[model samples]
Target: MDNIDRKMLEILQEDSRITIIDLAKKLNLSRPSVNERFRRLQEKGIIEGFTARISHEKIGKGTLVIIQIGNLKVVCHKFEEIVKEEKAILECHRVTGSDSYFMKAVVSSTKELEELVDRLVPYGQLNTSVVLSSPVSNRTLLPEDEFLHKN
Candidate 1:
């Protein structure tokens, strides 16, 4: 992707609802050109999908927890199935180091967290932390800036 594509991604990351005309104005490109570039980016899989950022607190899921699972004896697929069955697990990553998996979960209360932990105990040893506050959350990548500026 070029500089224009990078700019487009940066802008879109901030607001995916931006119109083609507005995006064109920001990039100093014609509307059709901007639209075509966006289409190409989508086709190339650089732009995966657009989604809304919701407030978990507002939705009654105020508590945020990070869980690190170690010493997993269950099959990977079985573990994945269990993870998928959980409604509270928002994100799960197959991590390196001492941990086999890292999961981000949201719940209403401490009781809910305990129940979730109890369910996961049979699969592995869990280390959990309740998120106090997020200083920086959901950061978007700017690969072009890194690639272009390297000297």
Candidate 2:
């Protein structure tokens, strides 16, 4: 992808709901060209899909727990098959050291957390840490510091 494509991607990543006309204006390109580029990007699988970010607190799932999973081998192949049916697991990652995998789970109460841990035991050993509060969770993936970083 060229610089223009990357710029378009950056804009879209910030807010996917922006209109075609607005996007064209922002990128200083003709509407037809912008539309065509978007279509091509989609066709090439560069623009996979669009989705909304939902707040867990608003959805009545305020509790966040970081679960460290251990004693499991062959995670890449089997992990998906195992977790496909589970709904509470929001995110999972294979990690280094004593922890084989790190998982993010959303629960309503402490009892539910216990139950969730119980369910995960068959898959691997679980060490859960409840998030008391998050002062900041910077969800941005783009490099915002290149221009802003003073140092």
Note the Cα lDDT for every prediction shown: 0.93, 0.81
The true-versus-predicted C-alpha distance at residue 99 of model 2, in Å, is 2.4
Q: What is the C-alpha lDDT profile of model 2 across 1-151, one tens digit per residue?
A: 5667767888998899999999999999999999998998899787889998788878888899998888865465686677656688898887899888888888888888888887778877779999898886745444345533531
Model 2: lowest-lDDT 10 consecutive positions: 142-151
TM-score of 2: 0.79
List runs of model 2 lying over 4 Å from the truth. Answer: 73-79, 134-138, 142-151
In Å, residue 101's CA in model 2 sits off its true spot by 1.9
RMSD of each: 2.0, 4.7
Can you give the lDDT of residue 55 in candidate 2?
Answer: 86
Best by lDDT: 1
lDDT of 1 by residue, 94-125 (tens): 98999999999999999999999999999999
